[model samples]
Target: MALHLFSSIRGHRNQINALSRVVARGEPGHAYLFEGPEGIGKDTVAQALLARLACLDAAPQAADACGACRSCAALLRGEHPDLVRLARDGATIKIDQVRSALGRLRFDPVLGRVKGLLVESADLLREEAANALLKTLEEPPSRTVFVLVSSKPQLLLETIRSRCQVLRFSDLSPDDVAALLVAEGVAPDAARVAAALAEGSMHRARSLCDPARMALNDEVARFALALGTAPPTDAAAWIEQIAERRATLAQAQGADSDNAEADEEPAARTGKTALTREDLQWLLDVLRAVLRDVVLCGTGIDAASLPHARHAAALHAMANRCDIGRIVAVVDACQQLEQRMGINPNPRLALSALLVEAGLRLRAT
Candidate 1:
């Protein structure tokens, strides 16, 4: 079967064409930093650029990969010897990985004419790893291309950032995300809801389609709504319930790791933890959405403009109970929780603190 190459990517035509022009002119840069928010197509564009560089028919003239060449086939199978991809190992990309990858760059292309290195989540590279990568970027190898994909490009070292051509990617519109989801067979209503919640990320829009994820978001949003009406005792109980669930999940995950086979399918492996930082972020995102709706409702914004249209009743009720000032305060607290979650804070404590604070503020209003 022929390797599948990107024919079209939503919201990235300008960036794609710009890189394609570079390839067609035979003046592609040695290093490019594709920076943007998650799911904004930086990685996708990088892959397309790499495919174009590696494609025999596309090189030196064409703007896109042919997708039928042996190089494209190898790329699809991850068997392209000249192309290297580096991802985070746990939390950071270590110095050793960068050193090895850089060393490989010094060698002649193993199979294809162009050597490509793609480093995902480049912001997660450790200081030593960044320094190591910087050396290679400063003096790149011949016929070699390096692409760094990062959502948090500011976290990268200043010296490293200065060494590469930076391409900025903008967020996709909700309509764009919804159109893609509908094309993928999602119901139009569900697709719109997911896109609205996705905050310009198709990656997040896909996650929102997962029943488990949506259920969790719904439960969290309901909890946020209850804060205005539930008693103090009920709020404490809710916190305890969340803590218990986290602990239970942690124990199950530990057991699964100890007993599961190395070859176990990820879907077959049970006991995925729900209290991860990412999960907490999602929870906060849901809360933020609800708080936003409340603010909108309080300020007499049109109901059609709200993302959580299904929860309009609850949102409007909350809006009636609290003024815009109190709602804004809660939203600010939610934002703080998001920042804290990113910095390795304790999940249970951080979540509980935010919920409790939100509850207190809501009740005071």
Candidate 2:
């Protein structure tokens, strides 16, 4: 059987078909950008595209690969000489890597019908690296394709952005996520809960299924509940506990494992041994979800819509003790914290201030 492009992807069928049509028409662009949130199947699509472009036995009108072909087999094994996947150096994609890859692109395809370069987490490309990549995109080689995958395309240089054909991937709906989870062997009930909490991310939903991660989320939820009842003196302690927990997680993941959450997140291009910005943002996201649930409960939204439905009672109690105005403020604070975290702020101080403010606001009413 032929290996259809995006055959295993749960969503983005339209996007996949559009690309397939391009391939069938023999009009695949020399430079393309796959922009979307992490774990939303951008990588899968890229791989499939590579296989399609390199398939030896595929017909000119075919939209997929002949799985039995030697080229297709090589692609499946990730050893195709014509396919090159680039990753970050230490924390960013440095200029050196870009120059080197561009140098390789100067050569003709050693095997397969097309030469392909895939830059995962392309947003991590530094200024110099991006400039170098832009040059290549400007005068791209014939019979070659460059696929740049990034969750944050805005981080890429505008010049670089303008040169590529961009394909946007939307988040998967809850129903779609639930169906996928069920197909992956998760119980129906668990799949529904995980889908609700996934925030349209399969990677997040899968992590939510892990006992350890779920326990961590539960601990955060418990702390959010106790904030309404605990004295103000306990604020610092709660913040410290969260920090300690983050530290432990950071240790478990180690410095190089910053992308362990999604595997596609950029590594430290500088080779530093510490948590990347993404790790801090992830913790903030957890807190933000808790605050969002409190707001939902305060506003009388149905429990069915709550991502943390299992903690509905605690959330309701917290909701009763706080006004809608205060809940909004906390959510706003979380958003601000998330944005600020990108600028290299002191994590401990920033997180402490946000949590303390949330605590004070919840008790105000």
Q: Number of the top candidate by TM-score?
A: 2
**Candidate 1 at residue 141, lDDT?**
87
Q: What is the lDDT of residue 180 in candidate 2?
A: 86
Instruction: Indicate the worst ten consecutive residues by lDDT in candidate 1.
Output: 262-271
What CA RMSD would candidate 1 show? 7.4
TM-score of each: 0.64, 0.65
lDDT of 2 by residue, 163-234 (tens): 889999989888888888899898665576577668788887876665555677778767766664556746
- Model 1, residue pairs in steric clash: none
> How high a TM-score does candidate 1 get?
0.64
lDDT of 1 at 2: 20
For each candidate in the order shown, give its overall lDDT on alpha carbons. Answer: 0.74, 0.75
lDDT tens readout by residue for model 1, 43-151: 7778878878878777566676776777887887867878888888867899999988777778888766688999998998999888888888888889999999998
